[model samples]
Each structure stands twice: as structure tokens, then as C-alpha cells.
Target chain A: MALSAFILIEVAGDHTKSAFKTIQRISGVKAVYTVSGSYDLIVQVETENLQTLSDLLLSKIRAVDGVTKTNTCLVLNV
Target chain B: MALSAFILIEVAGDHTKSAFKTIQRISGVKAVYTVSGSYDLIVQVETENLQTLSDLLLSKIRAVDGVTKTNTCLVLNV
Candidate 1:
């Protein structure tokens, strides 16, 4: 089954738009929404499994230009 | 503009299914997905505005039978 998750992102400086665009283009990201609260955005992601989910977060999401923090809430089912 | 949010919920005991069903019926709850990690479910909510969102969370969602905790991340735009 595919792994699904929601990533809560915190961007640094004035990079919300740029970071949003970059994060949306990532291969496994399904949807990205700008939100208000403790975090700036919510990203819905799908991956092959736990390993891929981790790699996607570390190598892709966190690598986005202004993404300073990420908190992932993994979906339990496919 | 409508207010949107993702509510992370924590269910108590064996009430996941029951809590999910009850929550889905609430007026402003748009979608609900069972998830793992720190939260048990992620509920997509849409309300008329911030005040309505607050009322829904405080008066409805928190009042669900098995919902022990709720963390709301309100969507920015309609």
C-alpha cells in the first residue's frame, strides 16, 4: 500500500511563495495548501513506504529553499 | 470567505470508528482521514469564518464522544 502523509511546513523570511512553489513540484507531493496557525502550510504526500517517505521529507521537502521546519502526520492506510 | 482547516485528532480507547462516524456528520467537517504518528485522524474543515471555526471546534468537535484532543490548523483562503 502507498504511504500517505501531511507535512506541516514552516518557512523562513519572506519565502512563503517561493517555498510553496518548490514544494508543490516535488514528485510525491499530492497537494499543498497555505494555512494560518503554528505552521504556514500543509502538504499532502504519497510515497511507496516508510523509507521513501523519510527520504522525500529529508531530501526533497526540507531541501526547499525556505522550508525551515516540517512535521509529518502519516496516513495509516493506502 | 470560508475558513478551512486541518484538525488533527487523538481518539481515546477503541473509539476510532465511532469517533470518525460522529465527526463526519458535523456541519463544517469536509473530510476525515484516519492517520498514524502523533494523531489518529486528520479532519478537513470549512466554516464561514474564524468565529464560526472557533465555535465549531469548541462546541461541536471537542464535544464528540471519543475525541480526546484536537489541534486545528486553519486554512488561509476560501
Candidate 2:
């Protein structure tokens, strides 16, 4: 089963555009949106399992320059 | 452009299943997931504009039995 999650991202000021560009390049990221809220970006990502999902979140997505925090909500019943 | 959003919902105890059934019946809701986290469900909804989206969230989605709180993230750049 494919695991899909929405990552609510908060980035440092002045890094929004650059962070958006970098996040889109990450593997399995289906969509990235710059939004108006407490969070700056909402990212839709998919991976084969929970392990890969965590890897993407911790290593790839959070590693982007502007991203300060990521709140991940994994889809349980789709 | 069609406006889309993800609503992170927290519900009352033991109301998950009933709420899930009730939510999917709502007009604009595209997908509903039972998730494990601070929030219990993740709902994907689409409307013609922000006004309609807000109406759906406030009037329809939050009105469901179990749903106690909703945090909406509107898609700005998709």
C-alpha cells in the first residue's frame, strides 16, 4: 500500500519562494503550495511505506534551507 | 480556478466511524481519511472560490457529529 501524507511546512521569512522550488524537486512530492496561514506551505507526498515517508520528511523535506518545522499527518484510511 | 483545501479535523471520542460516514456525504468533500495524530481526520475539499470553501468548512464540515475542531489550509500555489 502506498503511504500518502500532507506535510504542513513553516519556513523562515524571505525563503518561501526558494523553499518551494527546492521542495518540489524532492522525490515523491506530488504537490507543493504556498498558502496563507500559520504554516507557509502544504506538501502532498507519497511513499511505499512509513519508513520511506519518515526518511523523506526528516532527511529531504526538512533539509531544505528555509523549512523550520514540518507537521506531518499521515493518511490512515483512504 | 477551483479552490482546494485540506481540513485537519479533531473529533470527540468514539465518533470517528460515524463522523467519517457523515463527512463523505457532504457535497464538496473529495476525500476523507482517519489519521493518527493531533488531528483525527484529514479532509480534502474543493469549491469555486474562497467564500464557498469557507461556507463548506464552517457550515457543513464542522457541523458533523464528532468533529470538534478544524484547521484549514487553502492551496495558494499548486
Query: For every candidate structure, what is the RMSD over all alpha carbons to the true structure, in angstroms?
Result: 2.2, 1.8
Q: DockQ (C-alpha) of model 1?
A: 0.61
Predict model 2's lDDT versus the native. 0.87
DockQ each candidate and list the results.
Answer: 0.61, 0.58
Per-residue C-alpha lDDT of model 1 across residues B1-46, encoded as one tens digit per residue: 7777899899998788888888889998998888777788889999
Residues A1-78, model 2: lDDT tens digits: 899888888999889899999999999999888887677898889999889998999999989998999988887763
Residue B38 error, candidate 2, Å: 1.5
- Candidate 1 structure quality by residue, lDDT tens digits, A1-78: 688889988888888888888888999999999877778889999999888988999999999998998888877652
lDDT of 1 at A59: 94
Tens-digit per-residue lDDT, B1-78, candidate 2: 789888888999989888888999999999888887677888889999878997998899988998898888777763
lDDT of each: 0.86, 0.87
Please give the distance, in angstroms, between residue B30's alpha carbon in candidate 2 and its true position after superposition.
Answer: 1.9
Question: Candidate 2 at B32: error in angstroms?
Answer: 1.7
Clashing pairs in 1: B4-B75
In model 2, the Cα lDDT at residue A33 comes to: 82
C-alpha lDDT (0 to 100) for residue B39 of candidate 1: 80
Q: Candidate 1: which stretches are off by over 4 Å? A: none
